[model samples]
Target: MHIEDLAVPSVNMVRWGAPKQWLFVTPEQENVRAFEEKCRETFPWRKQARRPQRAATHCSQFVRHANVLVTTEALLDWGIDFSETICREGELVVTLPGTYHQVVNMGENLAEAVNVMWGNCGQVQSTYVCCSRDGCGHTGGVSQEDLTPEVASQ
Candidate 1:
């Protein structure tokens, strides 16, 4: 799917809005650790900087108390590219921590997605019980016992 830059940052994985799901990124595409160091060296993310290398925060919260949406140019200046990109069928998409990006479907389609969160962030745990479908949270609120994979397998 083709991702057009909406000049905003958001997560749209495994989505069914308007058509299909979408995913999106930058920073020399370095390894997670190097990228985190790069961000610390390049920008003053401060509080947000402390998030894990694989961690990602919305543009609104990427900066501390900025209270303003982040601009593509602003991200670009920090050596993070915010250009429009495409994800072919079955290809995996990943977004970097603290970078701003957009994801949109080019046509009607079907796909799956997963989310990884850094343990350091605030409320690292989900408030609601997760869906039995592994990695597909936010949809199920089963009791803790039923949410377990063993019970799900049975």
Candidate 2:
């Protein structure tokens, strides 16, 4: 629903709401660790996960709490004659969240980024719109509708 432009190798903020904005940057092990500490200093009770993609080549067939891919080089030149292009990298196309957005690293060098997610303690659940994928469909935002006190701790 929003677009952001950032200079290469710089940190960019993506505001999810209130104090939940994510600061995305290239994966620096130290910075990633420090950022986690800061998030905990504020919300000490939220569960978190920070890990590397299983494959050093292409990403696996799965999803994360959120993603911040750090491409030191260009991405693959794939065509998207379908789907609405919501964001771009200097005219190169990129997919937005809620869509089946996948990427392939074009450079032979390794690329990296750090992803941080909170509220994973049964407080939020992933929800999709029309359909998961294929044909006309786009996923919706994560939902907190089922987080009644009784269900939250389950």
Candidate 3:
């Protein structure tokens, strides 16, 4: 439900324990809109709020509490194309910019992640603009504090 840093790529290395299942959705406008609508329907309170926080897009908590998986087939029906992968112990996973992704650990897991900025300045600047417009707290090096209404309005 959330994207990694928009200007950087994230590398994840699983050192031990069980495998991790990852689901990714491309950052297409239609796909993101469909997923957001699904989230609002699943969590009705999100639709009731005047200005719901974007954190609601994080579906891991919902899946854990509701004990329901948002299946790939359902997403496909909603016109969302996705990619799935399983990363086992000692395996590495790399996520590129602008891709929304979710991860579920099959069991206990030990993993480490690092973000690397390798894009040109223009590309980085473009991501900053896109993230800012999208109100994406995790992207373009934006910190949570920067997303506050007061700060965001400035």
Candidate 4:
């Protein structure tokens, strides 16, 4: 991942690639829309139930055609500063609501991430802009009521 990475609110654990670099934008509600738009420019989040987490990998054709090199410029244009951080192995990066972050693996490596919203994590008006044409998206508030408390990967 070069730049222009779009992600939802979550925590990322570095299982490998100790010296991984990350790009982040301190999410301001007014700026989230623009930030998401910039990310969409590079990787559009579409497809059945697919989130931004899958765009960079699952959408091969889009990835090939998208010019993500302009990510830095896009971030700046949106009044969003892309902050870089390097995490060592076994480090966990927690993202607060309304913040946007991206990870760049130094090389072939493994990493695990989980997306969760704490019930007491305060209210962020946690909004996600979905590009789905299936009508499950909105540009504003996604409250706790919108999420489930458990997961079944099977």
Best by TM-score: 3
Candidate 2 colliding pairs: none
**Ordering by lDDT:** 3, 4, 1, 2
Each model's C-alpha lDDT? 0.38, 0.26, 0.60, 0.50
TM-score of 1: 0.30
TM-score of 4: 0.53
Cα misplacement distance, residue 128 of candidate 2 (Å): 26
Candidate 3 at residue 83, lDDT? 90
What is the C-alpha lDDT profile of model 4 across 1-154, one tens digit per residue?
2212123357777787546778767666566556555555645533323443334333322322243443666667767656778777788777765455556677766777666645644332333223232233432464334443432111
Top-lDDT structure, candidate number: 3
What ranges in model 1 sit over 4 Å off? 1-81, 118-154
Taking the tens digit of each residue's C-alpha lDDT, what string does model 2 give over 37-126? 433343322222232322211211222222433222321121111222222222223222222233443323222332222244222223
> What is the per-residue lDDT of model 1 for residues 1-154, given as tens digits with 9 covering 90 to 100?
1111211122334343234332224524363234344444545544333433312232222322222333456455655444555656655556543343445566776655443333332122232223222222323465555533345447
Q: Write the per-residue lDDT of candidate 3 for residues 1-154, one digit (tens) a residue.
A: 4555433468898899999998887667787667756755775654323324334334322222222446788778877778999999999998876566778889998999886555331144222322233333334576644533345346
